[model samples]
Target: MVSISDYGDFYKMAKRNIMLAILGFNAQKHFCDTRERMVSNVLSSLHKLVAVDPHSPLNFREVYTTELFGLSLIQNLGEDVCSVYVEEFGREISKEEIFHVLVHEILSCVVEPDWRDYFPYLSWLPNKSFETIVSSTEFRRDAVMNALIKRQKERIARGEARISYIDFLLEAKNSTQLTDHQLMLLLAESIAAAVDTVLEWLYREIREVCGGKAVTEEDLPRLPYLDAVLHETLRLHSPVPVLPTRFVHDDTTLAGYDVPAGTQVMINVFGCHMDEEAWESPGEWSPERFLGEGFKLADRYKTLAFGAGRRTCAGSQQAVSIACVAIARFVQELQWTLREGDGDKEDTMQYTALKLHPLHVHLKPRGS
Candidate 1:
């Protein structure tokens, strides 16, 4: 196993690269184009509909599962039906849940073509032929892109101002030599990483505040206790528990041990998160250890929840913002209670190769 230090290095590298991409995307010259404006308008409209319609049944899970299942609901259903679908499921609302939802959306929008071709098994699982899935997804994507492009052209004709990611990408297409697959891969990685990490942090923090009356913006500054809880949860249960495999290009020595070049290195982030040397009472949930004078507890990058080094998550700002907004909204708008007679049960956590998520929890609206 690679040492914790090595893991930290890779995490930081990953974070840096991802952040650069986010910065590139957010650059005024890139995002403020005509195409982006059109896309943003549609997204804003959707967000508004979700916010205003209290009876709307939609939530993060419904959106995510629909995308993952390749259902036509997203394509055909109106906002009201979407809301009803989510309400019927009564799923737990959390930052992590939203992350998965966003992942599916981003994948559907940007990665469908190459992804289906690269992973043919995805088509089989969805009960669709590879060619069929590819053709359909491609057609849908193109239609959306064309619509946005047309909107941009109309705005330009009307002398209206506009901005969008599509415009930046189209411009970049003329200047860069990136293949469609390469572009899609970059987009997939960004969406997946952003959504997953943000949601993980959100769920852990919200759970800490569960006993409180509600979470509010006024409570934001005084959330040291809650912050501690988030820290402890992350330390105990990192979402991405396994670092990506790294290949040594040349021979190296570590901690006085010689290793051959070209070896595959795997860092156990889960192990480091629970390492006794790095944490006191590593398994316990203690938020106090992360606050005030104890803030140094996180200085070592010992908690590799965000990874370390050059590859640290790039979308950390956006991810954190999304989590904060969602959590704030949940705390301000809803009251919750653990399912009857099951209040004492611990969270059922599950893991996969890429992420960890809460299995289930029964919570009812507090005021309902």
Candidate 2:
């Protein structure tokens, strides 16, 4: 029974930023009202997209995640609708720029080869190909994100009430000294993380659980399997495999290794998750292993998809809610299968992430 009203910071963030980001500040209630309703519409859109291409092998996975899911998240963050209201795209800029960031910036940065990562002293050595890709990704990401922020500014200036997470960030700027760059990056990452992980979530497991019937939020309580599947998804294919860099506060020893203060450490979360000492059959997707374990998923909860410690995702609850809605509705509506003859093709592991490469699926309408 987590009421939206219970989130006090949400109210404060919206209140402070709404006037600068948008006009007329009674947007808190509007945000709460649309939170669930927007998801319902998104679910409807996904079904419609699948319906349009039935009987043919379709890349419904790509369409749902890249087009529908990304669009839906943008709308939730602070837009009138999924349609890009502002005519900001040019020949140089892509309409799907955010998707480009997910694929190129985040995914490519992690998966691609770069010896500099191992030997920090060789960082100046050239990697022309990846550097070019990164340049393009950054340009597009910044352009699109800036345009979005500008649109919100215009909407608020005209006194149109638009309550969104971006507005919350605006509100925090005055009190918390949150910079505009920080705000836009926050919104951008939120879109990327929310859409990408749900795209890679265990759809097959979900299909098995829901049985081709659309799963409403009400039905979620009865479907513990959905939760377990999500848990296993994080365990096996954590979206953020390597954590952000961290610094040691004081000299210490860990696992019999000595560490000194001022050392910059990059934790290998993926390696920890796959270690055999903690997980039995660590490579396999096994949701049932968590059952009857009484929440002892592991001694230390090695999963680090959203990160760990005090810097763990602030919007974790909201992210999980979105994931649940997407998974339940998706599993309920479509009969999904891997593309023919590609059953043996496992998810591809990139330097930064592990996900299905060009995910293609044959989606048949449930009950048809």
Candidate 3:
């Protein structure tokens, strides 16, 4: 189990690198002209969607993921590279895939872009029926890495130093020795685990907010109700409902029972979150419970969204920031209603290990 403190550095590094990438993308004049301009365009588009009609059909997740991914790529690779990359890969990009790619890029910037340098095993093609697809992916990734490395080398040779994620990783004077394969595995693991978990929370919050009145920048500060809703949703439907199993280091007594060392303990976080003793109307969707003195649904330590001890999530802050921004923008832009004849309640109450989303609903333009 990793504690929050242990992961603080990781969180800081991810946040810094991701933001830098966003800024870099926006600074490109050929495509965006200015960061503010690009942001304004997106914001304006969102507002237009919101004002046009309360029931217009809009895929919030699709638009949000595309924009976010586009921004990240623009920052890290510039307009030309981002354009080519998207043209080649965008059609294949699902929400989960976008999250995976973004997480990998961010992690590489912070830790080691040449992580595969240590783990050569990852570069080898495995003997599998889908080897062709796997090999193609590997080739594409290697091409990107080679391009980045060449750029760095050119800067060095020209006596012009550049500060980039890759540059920082290369400059780590004291680093643990890891094989190229291990480094690739580490990078892959970070991306796969972090992205989907964060997206699940993000999608849930955005859906909830978009279910109500339009949300705008002016309404941001006053949206405690929205914040409360997000908090309550997270508490009720944690992405990873089952905490990782912990092995006991020593024999101990628990609830008057003796347990031997080496025993594995599993905590049902989902069950605890819904315990009648812990929360009132445990199964209902009430954001009010998370506000002010009523915010006692569960103990902070017991909230297993971030886990506990040494193994807690390392990207909590980044995840929250992404979710908050996406949700706010979505609410500000789109107006929606339950499908006709479906009653007044939301039908997106189901949960799965993958994600939680609303059922099909028709939305027409508010005025048209």
Candidate 4:
């Protein structure tokens, strides 16, 4: 229960969360070297591949995840880096499979048209297909998450001090009232924050903004075009497109229709951002729309990237910060090219957000 007018508690929680992950300025100092080095190596290798053969298709699923989230989990965070993840209640699973399962789970929770949702009387009956997915996804998520929890437990028992998202959350669990399930979900959600799918233009922007210098968090604000690109991206391909929902306190009218009290209402963020009335050409990709006058304080609603209003995402700012800094730095250091020969139009990908198929790209070393 929180006041709609106040966000102090939310801000405090967000502040504390920065410590849980390999996030924020102070905590980043500890593992920045490993993460940066790994990223640099990956970028260099890609650059060599593209330089050798420009049209070679690259697999970006693992590549992107490893850069943004995996290093924080595997290299210095989770134990048994060589061993695959396992569950306290289920069996073992591989690192490669974790992100895929996470996307599936996210898809399942979205407020799509379902008979069971509209008709509570049919609740007893289950959609076998969906049931199977849920059953499978629950096990996989638990397997990956539970395995991490167990590893941290073992580390604690062996008197080994680890500074990782897992360890940090474990210590703050009690004070923050974070359950094992909550901790697992936190890690689960972080693992699938995919912002590296689009690359070419961002690289150009970063290079231009930094004047061939390496992009850093401090350089993010000065790079106005890069900032606009991030904004348009979230608006177009929001990975998490729907909010959980809230109960209506009283009767209300919505677009001339009456919404009764105690009704569960959800926000379709994707729909909001895609509305033709709100956007000149919603379907097209245009970061230019967010430049100059678009970024005014009152104009934030054009893209409901992280939800809207007081009930909006608590970590919206942090999420954008991470995406901008990471993508900018990556783009600044390396260059990527689309490989059309490997496959046809990747117009439709079947992931949680309907993203492009993870494909290989040619890369070249960057002056920046």
lDDT by residue (275-345, candidate 1, tens digit) is 88977888776656776676684444677776676556444343343334334444433333323443244
How many clashes does the backbone of model 3 have? 24
Give the TM-score of each candidate: 0.52, 0.72, 0.54, 0.75
Candidates ranked by TM-score, best first?
4, 2, 3, 1
- Candidate 1, residue 7: the lDDT equals 45
lDDT (Cα, tens digit) per residue for candidate 2, span 307-357: 665456444544555567676766556566667765455556654453465
- Candidate 4 total steric clashes: 2
Per residue, candidate 3 scores C-alpha lDDT tens digits across 37-61 of 3344555665566557645555444
| Residue 210, candidate 1: C-alpha displacement in angstroms | 18
lDDT of every model, 2 decimals: 0.44, 0.59, 0.47, 0.62
Which is better, 2 or 3, measured by lDDT?
2
- State candidate 3's TM-score: 0.54
Tens digit of lDDT per residue, candidate 4, span 49-148? Answer: 6577765566655565655545645522554243455645346555555545555455554323457777888889878766665677677666766666
In lDDT terms, how accurate is model 2? 0.59
Question: For model 1, what is the C-alpha lDDT against the true structure?
Answer: 0.44
Where in model 3 is the C-alpha error above 4 Å?
1-56, 68-167, 193-223, 254-257, 296-302, 338-352, 356-368
